[model samples]
Target: MLSKSHLKALSFIREFIVHEGYAPTLSEIALGIGIRSKGVVHRYVQALAQEGVIELHAGRKRGITLPEPNKERDMTLPLAGRIAAGRPIEAIEDQVRVDLAAFFIGPGRFALQVCGDSMEEAGILDGDMVVVAQQEHAADGDIVVALIDNEEATLKYLRRNPQGDISLIPANSAMVPMVYAAERVRIQGVVVGQLRTYGKR
Candidate 1:
């Protein structure tokens, strides 16, 4: 965890680097955070460096640089290479994981390739990989991949019934929603983000 001032300084430094293409001077950072003291800003920067959240390049001016976050477990996901139709594919061991944090949040994330146009209206097209956050439950209207009766699975909007049933609603108006017993429906995961590729002309 970082202190409030430390976080503020990090934010300022990130925004400054993004817009200015370089790190800010301690004096500028002090002004950015309203500290009015370059010395205080230096100490904060030093603390951030000591915490391994940043680095201070020796013998260089405006050398403060943000370090990569020390999180590694969710940095990658198991890639099936090219697959997944109506069933969840088995994980391949000895496989290199492609960094997909760019697609979604949380550590329990996985990728699934779309095989149908049922979710096309929801902007999910065939061949797109949906990054899902692993969870057992989702709110109503959330697009989720639901395994019905521990066998057949479908991706659609989720809803409930007064009689304690689950409704799997598809985005395509040409398709009708399927209702099933709540006990038979298992939420595999909720859709968080998606990845798609375009062909070059």
Candidate 2:
């Protein structure tokens, strides 16, 4: 079990890594938590390191290494969205950042913002940011983001019939089901968690 002070430090460190995409330095951690000295923060971080929660890579710039969320008490993870797979993953630029590493239980994760009413009945309306785990395959009835016809990308429920035909299921009855030969559809990510901003509708 971790002491209260250790837990507080861990929470602050986790927040920094989530929002900043990098671990905070001792000074930054100290200041963020209302402490005055980097030395104090270093001591707490050392204790966390000793507990095997985080690893410090001394002599390397930006040397903090955090274990996967599976190794920690926080089960959520940030579901990252489609990145230019050809380019590097960019920094998060949302107005308010969420630490979703605890929510993403998958081994891989990413996030995307919702943009349509097709899934509105599921309460995933426009402007909701959903965290999706990157996955190449899923079982029937999994909600997934898929690229269809190379021109349209949609969020839908994947249904695989016994005959092996695949259909994209929409929650609302008004929208017709889209059926395709299983070979043409590409799975992007599986929905793991949903986050709605306070004011964004």
Best model number under TM-score: 1
Q: Which stretches of candidate 1 lie over 4 Å from their true place?
A: 1-11, 14-64, 67-75, 80-96, 101-105
- The model with the greatest lDDT is 1
Cα lDDT tens digits for candidate 1, 121-174: 898887888777779999999999787777565678899988999988878887
Per-model TM-score versus the true fold: 0.63, 0.52
RMSD of 2: 12.5
Number of clashing residue pairs in every model?
0, 17
Residues 67-120, model 2: lDDT tens digits: 875775544444333322111123233444346543243356656766556677
lDDT of 2: 0.70
lDDT of each: 0.75, 0.70
RMSD of each predicted structure: 6.7, 12.5
